[model samples]
Target: MQDEPRPDELIKAVADFLRDQIAPQISGHAAFKLRVGINALDLVTRQLALSADSDAEELASLKTLLGKDGTLVDLNSDLAERIASGVVDLSTPGVKDHLWRTTLAKLAVDQPNYASYRREMQGSESKEAASS
Candidate 1:
């Protein structure tokens, strides 16, 4: 379809250029806006790279929790109904873990460098090691 420097690579290159070159050279509101733009580009690049794996994992988790198969929107609706009706909840087996992992997956795509996300990731790894 397309050529070498793929979409994600192109997006990353633009964001990196803004962050490493333009942003540092600018000042005042322009600098702030430039950084914001760069962050948005970076987030898009991360999403393009990570969304497939995260969506697959999320779908699998939803299937396991709901005990059925459907599109992501359908499964999400089912999960919402179950939560709303008190049929299942965080206390229910697998629900909390599924929710946490899903949240982490989302954070990885939207804000991988976020401090709280990094902390939670380390905590999860430690918990897994302990359980194993």
Candidate 2:
């Protein structure tokens, strides 16, 4: 196993340094570019922290939905083909929930700050609460 200060932590540290130390010293376009770079770093950090579990869950869902096994990319392609052929779609059990979950996972990594994503997350939390 690796030592302390893992990749995500290191990335967060770098992003924090850039935002706290470098960002204030910059101005205009440079500041904008720095902000973009910091955002990219933050996204990478989130992916590193979250992708494994999300990907595993997605893979499991896809395998169950497709009734077969393959790499995530291959399974997704197969699913797409099935959807295109009208053999599997929202009418299929698990398809709708799987798609919604996958979309939410992606949005969590890619656009967590987006208003729609936030709303969807809130709705999901409400549903979970109601079900409990």
Candidate 3:
């Protein structure tokens, strides 16, 4: 595989440039669009940085929670069906934890700065320690 800067770094750099340099030079509708573009780039950077581990952990959680293996999409579909049919619910062991972890992982990539996400994360370390 290739090295240096990497895709995430490259995206972050462009986003930084847009936010710090370009945004200030524009106004009105163009400025609004530029901010949107920067936000999109930032999101791509977060996804590139976080999705690999997030997906792997999510896959593991699904396998253990469902007692089977499949593509993430397929496993998630099965989980959804089971949930809809009342075959699986929060009362199931690991179901709530798996859903919580999955939601946290997604929020980390989608909007890490969100206030509730920050509050949830502040308690995460203690919760992990307690569980351990």
- Per-candidate TM-score against the hidden true structure: 0.88, 0.94, 0.93
Model 3 / residue 40 / CA error / Å:
0.3
Off by over 4 Å in 1: 125-132
Q: On residues 3-74, what C-alpha lDDT tens digit does candidate 1 reach at each position? A: 889899999999988888888789999998998898899889999999999999999999998899999889
All candidates' lDDT scores?
0.91, 0.97, 0.94
How far off is residue 62 in model 2, in Å? 0.4
Cα deviation of 12, candidate 2, in Å = 0.3
Among the numbered candidates, top lDDT falls to: 2
RMSD of each: 2.1, 1.1, 1.9
Which scores greater on lDDT, model 1 or model 3? 3
List the candidate numbers ranked by lDDT, top first.
Answer: 2, 3, 1
As a whole number from 0 to 100, the lDDT of residue 109 in candidate 2 is 94
Q: lDDT tens digits, residues 15-120, model 2? A: 9999999999999999999999999999999999999999999999999998999999999999999999999989999999999999999998999999999998
Candidate 2 at 83: error in angstroms? 1.1
